[model samples]
Target: MEIYRAVVARVRPLTASMIRVTLTGGDLPAFTSTGVGDEYVRLFFPHGPDRHDLSLPVPTESGWETPEGRPTAPMRTYTIRAVRPEPGEIDIDFVVHEHGVAAGWAAAAQPGDPIGLNAPTGLYDPPEDVVRQILVADLTGLPAVARILENTPEHIATRVILEVPDKASEQALPAHPRARVTWTHGGNGHSPSRLAELVTTALPGESDLTGTYLWTAGETTALRSVRKHLRRTLGLDSSRFKVVGYWVPGSDTWTERWEALPATVRAELEALWEAPTDDLEDVTIVYEDRLSNLGL
Candidate 1:
């Protein structure tokens, strides 16, 4: 729940669709890293009429909050590409798009621009006995995927399937001794995502998944389909795979509808989340089904 303040120190283009921003500040010296490959943080940005007036959330006993009469800060989650503790600096890679607040900020970021971020949490945990790692992602999740490749153990064979908009968007990734990478062009906001389909074709049979681990992240809707296939259709255990949705299309509209829901309906959704269950996937299925029924 701790927040760290930093200023943009450098900006550079990584590829046609990605940019890297380097941040440094005194507060960054105290920042802690989880040391997990897919670790991420919630980045806070300036908001309101004065774009330079940073609007970071205030940490309270309950949680973070915004001051009364001030617009909530514009925040987004992003992977920590690299951390250089000695210099009190960290690198964040962003996928540039025509219509996202975070993308816009990254595209125009200048040195000395202020920013804030919370401590990181990670999701890329392969079991101790895992012999092979299957990593999947779209452009939005590429940074984390790259980090995972760099952190994978030498004994584990890795299979990477990356979906980028085009060949130009792809970059050279860290080399793994036992890695096989396949790149497919298309489906990164320009068209429908084929992440689930490609992953399905490459996955081992249900009976052969014992010592394997699967990790994937991308658009929310696309990931839901992947989750359904792995959990329900394949009957895969939740502990064997980590599936995360990095972004949702039309999020603004979705938020508006969610906020307008009746209190009782909201409580129902909360109960679904809090209910005890052995498989988290079951909870997600029911929660998302209810949201779809309400056109959320």
Candidate 2:
């Protein structure tokens, strides 16, 4: 994968737990992002007093290598919330939480500060001929969900189920052609499972799922439950459904469960990722809610 050295061009608060940062630099040229939901990027932030160190290596031999006894820097995974190529800008939405390096950096990011970015090497597109699209996710997966909603064809019926911490995070989604939007807020410190249950019950009737493409992403357990319900209970074709565990509760990264998926399933996903057709004729846009950019 190509690593880009980007400068913090802009930062804004989106919510108490989310921040929006726009980046620009020469590294962005190779980042030919197709649209929302089609890609994801990684953000690498500095650690400790070395925040001013712009001499870090580009993972190549010539760059400054890690000090013999120094600790590793902070890094996080985030979605490309928006991309503007005309001026060479890319926006990333980060969920701010305590003790996270990316969050800490975002909370205090300023223009001219240097950061590391890795270009997307994979794509997550559904089969172009699919008749319908079902998008499901939590805040972590919102950026991808929103992008898919914005770029999907109008004639292809789309349904989105987004679960947030509460009603306050429920922002308006970009209106897409022939799409139904559903926003579910988990109130009063409820668990992620609560959100999953709500989504399971609120899902459209079985009739709406035929010939539909299902995409589910969120906390690992929640994603697993939904995956079971859709494939086992509903008897949906496994080839048409995808469940991505963006993160796990009490864990810092995506689990290996995804890597252990059956070879058949993985092969199907690879096919979707490699598909080259743009069958959608129109794009739909939607937002759940806005939050203060915690600068992270």
Candidate 3:
């Protein structure tokens, strides 16, 4: 992925925990992002006492330089909330809290703040052969689910189970896809495990699970539980589904653990991640049309 510097054009609160920051600059036009979901991007925040220029370290022939005189900045991974390709604009949503550099920057972000961003190199959509789709996630995974629903066919049988802190955090999804959406509230600062239980119990019957594609992201333990249930009980192939750990409790960096299965299972998963030519064409068309209609 190529790195590009983008400035904050605007920032708005989507909910108590979510903040939407619109980024725009001449550098942004060079980024070619397909769409939103769980596509990975790198965000470089300013460092130093003044919090002005980027704080990245200078590279040396031997390796990276030492701590002294090295500008130390915080780097974070985030999802693309929305993208307007023609206008060279992209929206990133951050979950704000009391700690961490990314959250701190987001809380204080204002118009014209200079930030650095890296372009996305891959798409996160499931394979075209997938007959049914199961989406399991929390607030962090919501944007990805919404993107999939918007891009996929309306007749597809898609089931979504999302866990949020409360009803107020719930978002109205786009209208392109027909989905059976379920919400579970993690009440009063309770651990996300409570919500995971609700997700497991809500899984469809085994017969309905065959040939389905599953994508989940949220708390590490909770996501693991759902992954285990789908593999052990439903007898579904691992390669046909995936569970990504978006954030781990008590940690600032994101760590992802993919469930390792047999060689056959790995092959199946590889195939699913690769997009078909037809699907790629369709995505381009949909994205172009959406852009034109929005007058962006």
Candidate 4:
């Protein structure tokens, strides 16, 4: 858990509810990421009233150590939307909402703003024998889902199900000739049952799942039920699924919840942080929609 300091280099609105922030600085040379799709980092955002301080517990051999008098910053987990180490930059796509630590920080971020971040870790790698896959996400987990979709082998069949409040919130996803995307507006200004139903109806049957992978994120209850259905009802093996509860609806203690994420997944991330393998050269990310933050 090495702490790295970064200064905001660029901030661009990607959609009605998402903003892409590029962080770069001299201090970022030490930041090395495996560039694995679905990798994330713990962001120690400025907290309290001013949102100006970068104070937080420093990582040590034993664990994080809080200074005697400094106020610990609020922490949030965000997918490493993209990485380009040659230029010493990392992109983080944040869902801009009215509240929450990362949301507020992203809403107000500007160039030269300082931010603290640590641990670029990941748990997703397209299974070697995967015949096909299904990806699902909402605004919060869109970054991770997009990363996976973009990197998936194009020869394999894949489907993506995305839920947003409205058409304006739809961010253009990566293009893969063999992949298809289904966009559904999250009815009633929420993303839950409707998206889950789409997922349920679209999944491959048990006979066809032997060489498949199921990856889903976003609202906890929805995906939790999705996972349960895949495992219990469809008789898919647990090893064939990667389900992450990106956020529980209306959760205020998000940081605390993230810290307690599934132990197996946390272990996977910890192992990656310890010994990240895949080395990728300078990579560039492109988005089709150069849209503004037009609210629904």
Strongest candidate by lDDT: 1
lDDT tens string, model 1, 1-296? Answer: 88888999999999989999999984898999998998999999888545578978887786688888877889989999988888889999999888777888889899988888998999888888899989999998899988899988888999999999999999899999999998998887789999888778877345478788999989777777677778877788888899888877778687888989999999999998787788778889778777768876
Q: What Cα-based lDDT does every candidate model obtain?
A: 0.87, 0.66, 0.68, 0.74
Local accuracy of candidate 2 as per-residue lDDT tens digits, 160-263: 87888777676667788688888777621255345457556745446566567877777755554565566556766556776676775545432355465667
Q: Give all TM-scores, in the order shown.
A: 0.94, 0.74, 0.75, 0.81
Model 1: residue 47 alpha-carbon error in angstroms: 0.6
lDDT of 3 at 29: 85
Q: Per-prediction count of colliding residue pairs?
A: 0, 25, 1, 0
Clashing pairs in 1: none
- Which scores greater on lDDT, model 2 or model 4? 4
Per-residue lDDT tens digits for candidate 4, residues 105-124, read: 88888888888888788867
Who wins the TM-score comparison? 1
Please report the TM-score between candidate 1 and the true structure.
Answer: 0.94
Please give the ranking of all candidate structures by lDDT, highest first, separated by commas: 1, 4, 3, 2
Which ranges of candidate 4 are over 4 A from the true structure? 187-192, 204-207, 253-296
lDDT of 3 by residue, 1-296 (tens): 45677889899998886888999994898888855466768788897545557764434565333258766567888878778877778888887678878888888888888787766733455666777777877887787777777777776778888888888788888775458888878732345355456556666554565556877777654455565566666765556666676776646332222233445644654555376653333333343343234332
